[model samples]
Target chain A: MIATRIIPRLDIKGPNLVKGIHLEGLRVLGKPEDFARYYYENGADELMFMDVVASLYERNSLQDIISRTAKELFIPLTVGGGIRNLDNIKSVLRAGADKVSINTAAIKNPDFIKKAASKFGSSTIVLAIEAIKQPDGKYFAYIDNGREYTGLEVVEWAKRGEELGAGEIVITSVDREGTGIGFDTELIKSVADAVSVPVIAHGGAGKLSDFEEVLKNDVSAVAISSILHYKAITQFQSQKDKLEEGNLEFLKSGKKYSKIEALTIQEIKTAIASKGILTRN
Target chain B: MTVNLKQVVIVDYELGNLFSVKHACNKVGLETILSFDKREIENASAIILPGVGAFGDAMDNLNKLDLAEPIKDFIATGKPFLGVCLGMQLLFEESEEFGAKKGLGIVPGVIKKFPKEFRNKKMRVPQIAWNQIEKPENVDWGTTALKGIKDKEFMYFIHSFYAQPIDRSDILTITNYNDFEYCSAIHNKNVSAMQFHPEKSGEIGLKIYDNFKNLIV
Candidate 1:
């Protein structure tokens, strides 16, 4: 039995760590590296850095951040957002990311996944699918942080991605993102069952039980953003003086999100592990 | 030849995570140079072969740079040598990734992929999760780079193909995944290799580099 992975997902806007509800109205947190270091020290299974606005801007700014963070933290880092070509993937890997997740480019050109997997090895590529429930009760794939819809069904797309050589898939529920309502287990289970590769569940997750609930869906890992970020902000207390970009007002005005309950990575892992789930200690 | 004794040469074949491996070595207070120069690798006190990519491509890059012979020669010197992830797989004789591909043949083994289906149940390839490293029978870790590390310590792994040493005595540590236990690390005299990326395994992983640094003298 493989140990369930607990990953802390950090959404970055420029240099500041940011979070948004349903992938909109972004609120700036403190330094991403600070939060990353904290999570690593506190027993995070892995760390994910997603540049939330990289696609709209058509450029990634997290290279420097990834480099700096990779030096101190010795954990697997998966980077996503605006990874368009082989060069982009190469640069990120050179910056010390173990894997590069692709959502937009892969949807635009499915063959890109095949080329990347063959060139960089399948395990180095991750297919990220943003899904939202439609009126027909079917999940449709969305891109650009849930701003654009692709019309393709989530489960079918995940299965195609695996056939195209994606070593893993990360499905983020646009409807549940940042809501803290709990994971879209239905969406996760559908994708997990459709593909043989490992699937990582992202978005939602308000409490510890939320993790246990999703793990039962057969997700290889759980990526939580607001839950861990909020807890970390209160615990670490961002130094407002060091921040340079994004909306710093949130940091200045007591970082708190009423929609989600703050929970540490260790707290979530211990809670889930007690319920007969295997996790890395 | 006068070896630096403090600096470790990291073979750069343009396929692996040279940056993180070099960074990890630096964190452990060891000087490192990312190079493919034959003379540099041959003269270095220790060598760390770190990679993450297709086994065939890795071998092609190494051979293209004329590094195949130099690496084998370095190991023959009996100085500390470490292989991580694909780098460890490259030490074997052949791999089944994308059809049978030849390896550096330093250790007697062949790389095999995890079964797509195990016991009528589908198994995920590229076991991209943290798994434990347990000691084999009669094998004491106190004398290897895993020294001071706890038994069954979790290390980060991301690979589809795993090494199966023809000589069982070369097996250093084993890890269980998909209802199958496979050799995850190997130690034979001078060569020590791990399928997991110790450079990305956190504090416990840094301890491996620290132990490797201690072996430099």
Candidate 2:
């Protein structure tokens, strides 16, 4: 049996790794390459880099970052944000990303998925769907980092994307993103049950149980952000106290955030494995 | 031969990301180059056919570049050669993906799509996930491209169709997705191809490339 993947998703703004509460109040965590190296060493199954400002800036500013990350980080890297066309896909691939995830462009030009899939193979193209629950207890797809609504239901859009040759669908919950709440199990289960391709449940992974909750569904993988980011900060904070007091000035000057003792990838995998689910040891 | 000058050529058929492949080779301390030039193809110490695109288009590119025959001829020389993902599928005789299309016929097999449903459960196609590879008993892969890797170790996979080698003896590994078992890696003479991407599969994945590096060395 295939083990479920535990992926660390990093949202990039400029060259810095940023995290936001509910995808807002963005705070720079650190350099992407540094964090990527940390995650790669710590047993992250894959890494996802999304340029949160790409669509707004209209340029993929993380190309160099990705290129650098790919050099040292040997795991699978999936890059998203502002991927507008085949050229954007080509450039990202050239940067050494294994897969390109598209959200807005996929909605604007449905044919873009087909074109990219036809050109780069469906496996290289991932359709990222940011879904929101409406008042009527339904899910609708949103794009542009959940700032715009597509008016298309999540299930229907996922089916369409798969039909258009998308190899996987990453269903992110707008309702739960960055909240550290938990995955929208109902939404993920429906989407996972709807598509014939693998569905990755992104957003709202606050604890090991959260991963287990979503993994119980048909999701092939889970994309996490805040929890892991917090964990890295916590780990770094422990080392800071061991350094000379004057050396702490460098850490303070770089970036500072309250740390949480979040679980490591191995711990999460162990937790899941304890539940009788197989995971890479 | 000078150190750090080994020529491991990645056959670029104008499909997929050769950068990661080259980076993996470089990480393993193997000098890598991406080219479709026939002379480079014939002269390389080893050849890697890495691809991610339609079968027809890949074959079309190889045919247009006049690399199809050279590839076979290069393989005929018995130097190490590897095919990845779509590159692996192209080694089979035919693929039913996007209609019936022919392959390079390097391996006696047919590429098949996973059934829509398996064992009363809805099976996901394209199987984009990390699955373990079960090694066959008869083959001694202790010194081959799969060296330093244990049986049933996980590898990242992203594909809808899998190759069905006609000779079971040629299969190097098998992976179970849903109720069915499919050939995950095939090894024949100087040629070996895998359905998964070693470049994208982390540490163990790097070991596979290192093993390949050892093979050519």
Candidate 3:
């Protein structure tokens, strides 16, 4: 049995790590490097750093953080957000990202996937699709963190992405995102069924069962943020003790943390294993 | 015997993630040099070809940098030569990635795409996940870099195509994905390559690199 990947997604806004519900209400968690190292130490199969505001900002601050993390972390690192052109892709890969996920940019220039995949390799390119369901129950691809819409449906878009040389497809549900309700398994299954490349199910994972439900489908990996991050805090009981000494002050005294019980990567793997799903232990 | 302190050199042909491989080697206390210079490769105790890109483009870069023949020459020296991912593919004779491209030809094999039958069914093309690898029938896992790693241990893989070695005996391990079992690792004399990325496979992965470090030492 193949080991399903349990990935920790760190959505970055400038230098700080931020999280939001439905891709809004941006809250800074801490430094990207700190969060990245924590996840790596805790058995995160892979790490995804999405620059949530790279399009709005003038400068991309993720390169330095990725470089620093790659120096220490051996697992594959994927950097997404604001990757628009060949030069952008080149610089990110050169900066030490094993793969680059293109969402808005690929939608804007569909041929960019082909060009990037050809120049670099299909394995190095991942298509990040943000899907939102419409009134008719049809899912359309959204861009810019689900703020905008492309008329194209997600399943069709994922197939096209694979045809265009994307090695993997990352399907993130905008409607279910940040809600911690659960994963949109239907959406995941639909896209995973449509594409031959590996599909990573992202957004709206709230519990252990959430992971199991999605993994039972064709999802190759799960891109989780809220559950993993919150779990890390609650499991440790306090941020002061859980976090490294240098970054202790990142969590302010008056700030409220998620009361939801957290689970570690090992715990999640064990839960998945109990369900008869094999994962890297 | 003058022991070489710097035991590994990750060849940089301007293609894949070279940093992580070097980082993995360093993590295991194996000194490495990320070099494109032919002389550096010739002088190193071992050479690691790590890449992720189109087969045609990678070959083009290696040819452009004139490191292609140097790589073959180094392999002939019988010092351990490890090929990772695309690097593993490049060790073969040719690839069907982009209209039939030639590889370094160190190993008698051809790089091929996963059939659409599996693609149309349960398995994905790239098979991008952590998958278990088992030793070839009647072969000890010790013969390859997978030494000390338990059987069926998971390693990270991210590729659509797999290698078909001309000699079945050259295959060190096989991984089952979908309805097919494909060669996951190849070992021939002092040359070895794996389709999986040990650098991205975590602690067990680092242990594999550590084993390779010891093999060369």
Q: Which window of ten consecutive residues has the lowest lDDT sum in model 1 chain A? A: A235-244
What tens digits encode model 2's per-residue C-alpha lDDT throughout A245-269?
2223435565533332366777888
Q: Which stretches of candidate 2 lie over 4 Å from their true place?
A: A235-261, B1-4
lDDT of 1 by residue, B7-79 (tens): 8999988887888899899998899998999999999899999988888889889989999999999999999
Best by TM-score: 1
lDDT of each: 0.90, 0.85, 0.85
iRMS values in order, in angstroms? 1.1, 1.2, 1.4
**All models, RMSD in angstroms:** 2.0, 3.4, 3.2
Shift of residue B45 alpha carbon in model 1, Å: 0.8
For model 3, the stretches where C-alpha displacement exceeds 4 angstroms are A234-261, B1-4
- Score candidate 2 by TM-score against the native: 0.94
Candidate number achieving the greatest lDDT relative to the actual structure: 1
Residue pairs with clashing backbones, model 2: none
Error of 1 at B36 (Å): 0.7
Query: In candidate 3, what are the lDDT values of residues A70-97, reduced to their tens digit?
Result: 8888888999989999999889987889
- Candidate 1 per-residue lDDT, tens place, A157-230, comes to 99999999999999999999999999999999999988989899998999887888888876799998999888
- The residue-level lDDT of candidate 3 at A181 comes to 85
